[model samples]
Target: MESPDRTVHVAYDPYVIPGGRTIHGRADGLNGEWSVHLGRQTSVEIVAGLTDGLTRPRSAHAPNV
Candidate 1:
């Protein structure tokens, strides 16, 4: 994904095997934030523009760190 608060366009290439379409849209929000899961080993949450804010999500089976 590109930077936030900017317009982005995406197009899927067709004719190779199947078919697809293009999508265009814009987004406006506070800042970018993301949560990623790495298999069943761990999960990570990150707030854009800063690494100090990185963290793991709370879970019933996981102990607080």
Candidate 2:
């Protein structure tokens, strides 16, 4: 998945690394700023949940509710 403006991107690829899957990210189209190696023993659902929280929008103040 990517940011709405497309300056940031995150992806998961199992084949890019030899022993395990990876979640890699970059900003401004530059070289990867960071990566998380799931170490061959993680599930897609967990990854999805993580990335969802990572990319989800946020607000400075709490809602009234």
Tell me, by TM-score, which candidate is best.
2
Runs in model 2 lying further than 4 Å from the true structure:
1-18, 28-32, 59-65
lDDT, candidate 2, 7-63, per-residue tens: 445555556655555555664453546767775577778877767765667556836
| CA displacement after TM-score superposition, residue 45 of candidate 2 (Å) | 2.2
- Predicted structure 2, TM vs. truth: 0.49
> What lDDT tens digits, residue by residue, belong to model 1 across residues 1-65?
42343344334445433444333444437434332322222222322212222222456875644
RMSD of 2: 5.9
**Worst lDDT window (10 residues) for model 2?**
23-32
